[model samples]
Target: MEIVRGRSVLKRTAVGRLQYYEKEEPSVVRRQVEDTERELSRYERALEQAEKELEALYERALGEAGADSAAVFMGHRMLLKDEEYRNSVTRAITGERVNAAFAVETVGDELCRLFLEMEDEYLRARAADIRDVSDRLLRILEEEEKGGGRCGRGPALSEPVILAARDLAPSETVLLDKKKILGFVTEQGSANSHTAILARTMEIPALVSVPVAREWDGRLAAIDGEEGILYVDPDPETLERLKEKKARQEEAARLLLEIRDLPDVTRDGTRVELYANIGGPEDVEAVLGSRGAGVGLFRSEFLYLEKETYPTEDELFSAYRQTAERMGGREVVIRTLDIGADKTADYFGIEKEANPAMGFRALRICLKRPEIFHTQLRAIYRASAYGKVSVMFPMVASLWEVEEAKAMALQVREELEREGIPMGHVDLGIMIETPAAAILSGELAEKVDFFSIGTNDLTQYTLAADRQNDRLDDFYDPRHPAVLRLIAYVAENAQKAGIRAGICGELAADPSLTEVFLKMGIRELSVSPSFLLPLRKRIREICLEETENDQGV
Candidate 1:
């Protein structure tokens, strides 16, 4: 048995047949074609067919997978409609008189190379998505060339297997069968990468940067995601040890299931509202399955991010309405478009900043661009008619910003009332992410229905560290005294104002900090669906009074 160490993204064991996702880099060549019109037609038809295929995939993914997962196909559909991408292929086909298939490969290759050359890691990693979408178009063209028209559905595994890959894009991961795929092991990706985040969200055992995974194709392997170890061609002892570890993990999961439907209560009987933070309508399914109390942070930004341009009020309303109705009267806190910075859409025309994390983003942009902000508010207010829906503003720093956001919502309410549209009770809340918000939580609390502390941003802003920067890992501790103090301060002030105070960030899912939060009397915790059971178990195991007395924590 050979052991390889890698960075683990979750704590679990996966034992199964290994299947590697290795793509053969094609050798693109400009080939002369006899008829240019036919070749151009082939390219056009290929894009059309690719779009149709992606639409089918999106629908299937929506029904089977969740909305965030289904969004990958929508993204693919967008790429298929890229004007520049289509124009580039057309230029190559007409100008060089090359085969249409060859022109597609040529343009796709150039785009992939260009994205890879980008300095930003987010942009560089997006190279995988570009390649994935391009591959779909080429596959269609190639299949049609071979006299195979409209080959059925997507790729799937025959049986359960350990999915090994050179790298996994968020889009490609969506196409994978979650039930058939045991876990992920990649030759590339760091512990803090997007791949890692997906793995954690899925509760899948994953180890990244495992170079030896390149050679583990079609072999039985054992993965220890907690320890970041992979045993290839395991000896009897290694296999037996892995089997036992898997058994223990399964037992732990079963134990967690026992408390699945139970309320999140501490040993001292302090009941907390355990909820979910979701991005789309499909995520409501996961929330229901997990028995989450409600939707704490419905990231309305995702709808805007996925759109080609600004999502119309009707489209936004439909999505939010579906999500609210599905929740069946559960609390649905819809945060307005928190766009700009790293989470940007091209149509928004937000200029790149030297320090985007700290610059004009979230509520700052929404408040400045009131039209876009009002459009989202109108949709959200309309959706609230279906169920319990509250509105929250992100990146709130000062009292004036709070007053301004409330004023906009008031205008939306007045407009909707004048139009005689059915409206629901929409409670206003603010996301305490900036240090300025936390420090003055008491003043801010008096004006809102609730406060959801976005600890991911709060920790970074409090410590003056970038959440995305790996170099700041040492300095970006959420459990740091300063960060906890701020959270406690918010909770305390929120209590005084008779408002619900919750945490909807990575920290809410952290078992290590559960006791601390409980002691602070933080009433709500909304994490990803996978974290629901585990976090509930943690909450039940803690005593708020005991934890409060324990200074060593």
Candidate 2:
């Protein structure tokens, strides 16, 4: 047993491991490699046999316990077949290999080093994922040597296990027992990582990127997911207060669930459209499930993220059509490709820049790849026939860019007509994400149908602070007078142009900012599904007339 102390931050506590593997010579490596190969072969056979048994068990569990239970059983079965992991073991076994354990250790160390060098905090945290996979594989391989036959431990004794690691992979996250697991704490990760996403989906308390997590062990802890705070070794009084807090949280959750079916109205009645910001068509299901008013912002980058080539017109059309069908006449505002040097698709082959975010990206990428842009436009136009779908271009900096995008959109429409692609008209809009875009909002507003203020990027651009950087995060304040003035300017310009303006940013979800936005004359607020109800309640409580009057003051 170990007793270590550390301050917990953001609902995560880290515990360091006491044991470390010693490095050995090449001869030791050869012997271990031979042993590992034998072990790998044995495990492969045992895994095959275990899979057959598990399949039968799964069928019986499905018969007895239902689909959800069977799904849990089957999920474990699939974990065995993870190709990247299997290949790693194979390399350790059959290849001119180092010791399996040492090889895993070396890979983990190298991954950690690689991640540390990465500029993106999210990507850097993936080092933890590599370590986790290697550790799990080593454990499995070691078990095979011991003739435990891949059924080494019975799902880790379910004892309120608080998983403390440098980071967690998506697969390990999925396999953990949710009921017994208290929460997740990681040394490195971001709110956007798959672990965070899964944690939010499962309603688990999680904290990431805690610098001193290595020092925590057996310390009484509390996690507040909503506030993104973690408390360690709380005094008795604090624990009592936390107990009360936990009760209130439970009650709030119960109330929120009950009101899920209710219309989003406050003590005073006012109609406010509550919408979801979707990343792709798959996210449409979540919007539907949450009973969102519409699709406020549909980020089209997911189409470019994993693809080696740009999506064809037909592919884009099918995606848009599916989203439109799911939205069922609700407004779907699709934002055009926003990729840049920071987020390169293989097809784009974007050159890495010193400051990728500030360099050629977003709308700049579209300008450089007009053919790709035209194909997307044609598809969106064709999909418009299915429902009320509108198009928006991201990172527009000037009236010229807006005009150019509009011209390209029109050209796509003309081309579609000539090609007989069954196109329909859709409203074209521009996102105010860059500093220059905010500065020229009045002129740009005249060219676009509407404006969606992407506050995340706007804040970053305005403050010259990378929000991902912890050291400079304090400078990334959205409520900075400059940011407020920019939003106000854009909204005013949008209104003057006879077009509605919407805010679809992390700031939109902040209840405290709702009145400020309403005062700014913003017509819509698109936020995450979790925040929709609370924000809608805030909107309804606001007297827009009073807010507008106060704006002039």
Among these predicted structures, which one has the highest TM-score? Answer: 1
Q: lDDT of each prediction vs. the true structure?
A: 0.82, 0.66
Identify the runs in model 1 with alpha carbons over 4 angstroms from their true place: 56-65, 69-73, 112-119, 149-159, 192-194, 213-215, 305-309, 342-361, 439-442, 459-485, 496-498, 550-553
How displaced is residue 189 in candidate 2, in Å? 4.7
lDDT of 2 by residue, 56-151 (tens): 654543333222223333434543454545565567656644555555555556656876798765345445545544455555545555766533
Whole-model lDDT, candidate 1? 0.82
lDDT score, residue 156, model 2? 49
Q: What residue pairs are clashing in model 2?
A: 11-229, 11-230, 340-361
The lowest-lDDT stretch of 10 consecutive residues in candidate 1 is: 148-157
